[model samples]
Target: MHSDRHEPAPLRVELAGARLAGPAPVPTGVTASRPAAAVPHPTPTQPLSPARLDTPSTWPRRTLLRLVGASAVGLPVVAALAACAEDDTVHPPDPLAAQEVLARADAAAATAAIALAPGSHAALSTIATERTAHADALRTEIDRVIGVYGDGTTPVHRTGALTVPGPGGSPVPASEVETASAQPSTLDGVRDQLVRSQQSAAALARTESGYRAGLLASISAACATQAGVLLT
Candidate 1:
């Protein structure tokens, strides 16, 4: 036999808040209408637009970068200025001082003369005498012209030291010559040096006049004679 009561039908709804058309009182704020679609939030990896950089905090960061960039551009200029200032304080030595050149020549002759043993070489004594005379004549000339006796000293240098850049090496002490020469006897070395010195002095003499030129030519000739004596 069939059941006396029929089973209740299932409730039908289009959405969770769906309601029937009956005039039941709706809630104050809530309604049976569907809620609006959700809006997407900005992602952290997305770049900000130029307009977004108008904040005070952003301006301060940009200003710091500008200052850093300016300093980077200016540093090289400052360094170059400092280098030029340093260069201005330093000066090159005067190369045209006749007193200096003559003084060096005197010192060179004196050094070799002093090294020669007494009576060992008569020619050496003559060379020594001539060099002494040359020094005196130069001093007198200097007194006549510059009115002052220059520093009558030579700067001591190493053996075979090429102090100045020229075909002839600068004259040095006898002991320094011995140190420089490959052989035991430095007579050949001395002769070669004297020849070079005379040649250089003769070149310098062309620029002079009066007593100075005569004296320089005489000295150059005497040095040549001394070099010849060493060969004999």
Candidate 2:
């Protein structure tokens, strides 16, 4: 084997006071890559606080809640205003005394009509006289009730018609009245009218006295007896 000679290791070179050249030369087969200019590091963005992140979305909900609250408060106030508007138009003060007076007058007029019929007999006349007393008593009572309550007059009026009684509350037959002597027929007609009058008078007595007064009960009994007589 031939003797191999080893090359001595390259000695360290030291260049005293030597300046580094302009651009370092690239080594063969190695690319020279310049370090990109340092990219400016942007200041780290502050983390979005929860309050700020949620505030924008919650604003509309908050506005809606306020609107709902205001509507709830205002709805009843609006209803109260409407009720006040209706009350202003519907109510008015009225009189109670005048009604009593008118009722008394009506009873008086009805009694007079019964007493003044042409064919009225003694029995009928007696009932008319009692009805006249009833009218008078009613007038006094009305005055008393009215004096206790009020003196104002109401706008209401009576609308029904009144008539004297005939047979079974019907009109007398014209042929019978014209052909027959009026004396007997008049007595018969008045008898029937007397029955109706007594019945009506007894009813009035009950209404006026409420069956509490001895005088009214006595009058009612007498009227009922007379009604039975006239019917028989």
Candidate 3:
């Protein structure tokens, strides 16, 4: 028989017990790799620089602002000082030397009735005589200047006690002459009045002619000299 020669069942191999023995075998065509290059740690970025502050173009505008501010502070201070130093008192002018001299003569005549100490009466008479002479001289001066004798109506006695015209067609009441002479209780008061009256007379003389000036000046001097006699 040309028969089949059968290999004996390829020597039937058996594993120890029912488990495969020896080391576990690795797979042939597979590999293990690292995570996507580990995403290399990103480096920190740098910050930008700041802008410049001081520039030549802005300097002129700053200077102008400073000058305007200084003027606003200084001008009013100068104006205030100027306002504080002004004087405003006003005095009257000399009347026609003539008519006023008579008024003065009347005032002088009244002086005799005023009570005074011994020897002062003679001095008072002298003053009255001088005032009468002054009246005559002023009459002559008035005739020379305005070509007429000054009637009593003229402004020869416009003392502070006289009421007259003022601004805006208004009439201001005149200030009264403050005198201690009318009825003084004390001698010192009379002397004070005499001094003030003489000073006022001197001021009036300054407003008159050369002759009136001399007369007023003499009267003023005589009154001043007499004041000390009463004061003592």
Residues 48-143 of candidate 3: C-alpha lDDT, one tens digit per residue = 333333355666787889998998898786654453344233335335432343325334433633465444556555554555565576566654
What is candidate 1's lDDT per residue for 52-161, written digit by digit as tens?
A: 87688789889999999999999987875665456433333222233334434533543554454433356655555665676577656654553321345332211222
lDDT of model 1, residue 136: 71
Worst 10-residue lDDT window, candidate 2: 91-100
Give the least accurate 10-residue stretch of model 1, judged by summed lDDT. 156-165
Clashing pairs in 2: none
User: Can you give the TM-score per candidate against the true fold?
Assistant: 0.39, 0.28, 0.34
TM-score of candidate 1 against the unseen true structure? 0.39
Model 2 ranges off by over 4 Å: 1-128, 148-185, 201-216, 228-232
Clashing residue pairs in all predictions, respectively, total 0, 0, 0
RMSD after Cα superposition, model 2: 18.8
lDDT of each: 0.55, 0.45, 0.49
Which residue pairs come into collision in candidate 1? none
